[model samples]
Target: MKLSSFLQYLDALGLLDLIVKLKLRNSILLVIMCHEIGKNVYYEEGIPTKLFEAELRYLLKLRFTFLPLCEALEIIEEEPERPHRIAVLTFDDAYKGVYENALPIMLKHGMRGTIYPVAGFVERSVAHWAVQIGFILRNMKTPVKIKLESLDTSLYINDEYDKRIALKTLLNMLPRMDVDEINSVIQCLTQFLDRELLHEIQELHERTMMNKEQLKEMAELGFEIGGHGYWHVGLTNISRERVRQEIESSLNFVNAFMSSSVCKLRTFAYPYGLYDDNVIGVLKELGFHAAVTMKPIVNKANNLKLYEIGRLSPYRFGLMTLSSFKVQLMRVYT
Candidate 1:
């Protein structure tokens, strides 16, 4: 990211609020947002982005899960048994780095957390959509941006797959986008987008997902595996039947392969936190233990809908959360 772009991104109000609200001076309960780091191994420009290893030692205490997962788990266990509050470490996407980089760290620390995976990407064996997009961004020469119909900034894409992924992201995030408008925009994108490029990327990242043996091993290590839906599509757009199918099919595939009963993957982090009462109701009927949403509030077991625990997201860049966590810890606990 250019210096100017980075500065502008930091100026985002949502980002600012997230940092400020994190100073929970009165809260006894909390959770940490642990992210699965994407490729730092293969970037042509000497690593496109990174969350400096040093940062882990700084803000995150036993809460950091990279090199010190075991310690984090110990912290949880050592907490007072009041149920007043506990900090659970969680990683959103099961990136390949979870295996290559994170596993060793987790093992050394003996920390256990849930790995929420997009089912088809692992079970059926396909490259994750995000990884494919990142590959193109890291590989492309000319900086490309999608020319949108009404958007202000030109869509920035480093490669073809990035262009597709970014469009999909916008489609999912922008709720009021009508199908007619979507179709037109997608059609325009197809004119310059390279399907083959995305396909190649897909092939590469499928190999990146843990093979059956590795996944089974993850279970053996005592880490919980949760479903993050199949295809990782915008859940709000699909029909009720389709949602059930995605949820159940992925659960079936993982559960059956494990030689254990997943029954149903009630524990979910909604695809982009998009959920309807109807969608959740199906999960209730099916019997899910718990489901997590991307809501940014502390969750109470009694007040929650069971299938809708809120979570905090770790920012890609910033110092606010680090400093803020300390302030919250000092003011409230003392």
Candidate 2:
């Protein structure tokens, strides 16, 4: 098993707490990475809404102070010793569920968080590839053959399991394709399936991303808005000019939409949490204050970098019990 999984197993066994108690390190700021938070039929990336609420209550019970991402950054810079334990909640992709489901729970707890939305998706100019894939897979009635010329492979989906496998393989290959390539692949897949029915299904079930008005409301309601690129493509693998355009254009769109004092678009979350020195330089040049990655490390005042701040995904912790959550936090603290 992977080391992270093994650590989670140890945490489930209650050994991680003992290890953490023995180490006794200083308190640090933890950023929890989330995507969607609701009942999703096609995706498992999201935690159920009730479980999300329970996690928040559990954190509150532990006396962990929840702060907005910008506020957390300011505190770490201005007064590092103010809070013993603090966390910033952040969500990516700006799913409608976050606005519809997660926001209510956060407000109940008197907490605020950050959201990074793909500018293109919010503009309704592009559909999230994953959502599109899920719609196609679930709507397929008969066995179909899918030819992925980019991967030089042909996949046959004859059952639910085969459909899932094909979906997974397609998702894995999407980040590398450009806009036209991705659209071509989706178009090809749609031809094999029921295009008219799939469009209807997509119209009904696949409107999962938040629109501009919802995002505006979220910003007005004390949530920070950040950029997640224009097309949700990996920046590190793209050309330098493309990286600059993606980062700059995304931030520009977010700033124009929110237009709130509290919702300054100064932070960015890299697509797929993939970046390099070049990507960092691009963000720096664009006047962003900080950028977050999906790294498993905890963010401390002394060790935090503006460009490469690390965040922990709750799924990585195997969020089955409170003890497992504690162990996840401990993994980052050390």
Candidate 3:
């Protein structure tokens, strides 16, 4: 999945739509070359995180399904001014591998995208207690003291760069603690790991979050359901009435059982997309309409913003050409 991704090198630089469908540009360069094949078969050096998580689930199953049938059968079958149509295949903590591998590659290329999902880790495998206390004190062998209130580290991380310096020194002190010091450091590292290493550290984050019947089959497939706040935490470190009680308690948990979903559910992708300026004025007084940021830049309906929304972090494909996939999508949007 490294067809030199800068958004698949800006969709293979639409060079006259790959010179008018050279077989849909060799079938999206062989779907970004088997989407990074077996990417070092489940992460060797974690093969650049399994080649940018298999080319962002092969560019969200090639943008919600065959980039609109390769633009209605081969790039712009009808282009009357919608040229800013750059791919926006998103998926933040909207995980469960976006309903297992971006919805079966968006059913298999009938394509459509958008998913923000952190509504507090959905039907719960509940993560982000500082990446489950830095993978349980980086595979604790013992000697773990972490006190806080002044700092008294007992630290005993034996190797692998002292387990990435004890998981970046408790993620720079778990965002300055206080959720009862992050539930007493996730109950003192789940009382020194076990429950089979906390279910293999929640299956080492293969990204999970989609449950109530697969978010009701991604809200019956039209797919615009948004929101990410309910506990992936960080509304500029809490309060403005806890960021409207974490975005109206995650829009009442994605509207507890749809109940006729989409009610002016303007968009949101902030949890870990991080926010500020009073968290974009509490996502425009809680009626969002548009918000996304991991800040790479491309969304354009009159350049909307509650926060400077721009994205495209999926990269690391390594081959399948046109100058190495536009040098990894110009290194994620240049």
The candidate that achieves the highest TM-score relative to the unseen native structure: 2
Q: TM-score winner between 1 and 3, please give it.
A: 1
For model 3, residues 2-56, the per-residue Cα lDDT tens digits are 4344544555566523432332221121112111122221211111434444455
Poorly placed runs, candidate 2 (over 4 Å): 1-25, 81-84, 201-206, 263-265, 317-323
Candidate 1 structure lDDT: 0.52
Error at 33, model 1, angstroms: 3.9
Q: What are the per-residue Cα lDDT tens digits for candidate 2 across 1-334?
A: 9656776687678686666554335667778898888857364556778778877886776567887787778767777655457778999988778988999999988998888989888776455778777777877876778777856889898999998888888888777866667778777778777646855644633367787878788777778888899988878778999999999898788678555736343888999888999998888888788999888777776667878888877654454444455566665442
Ten residues in sequence with the least summed lDDT for candidate 1: 41-50
**Candidate RMSDs in order:** 8.1, 3.4, 17.1
Estimated TM-score for each candidate: 0.63, 0.88, 0.28
Which scores greater on TM-score, model 1 or model 2? 2
- Candidates' lDDT values, in order? 0.52, 0.76, 0.51
Candidate 3 weakest ten by summed lDDT = 26-35
Candidate 3 residue-wise lDDT at 232: 65
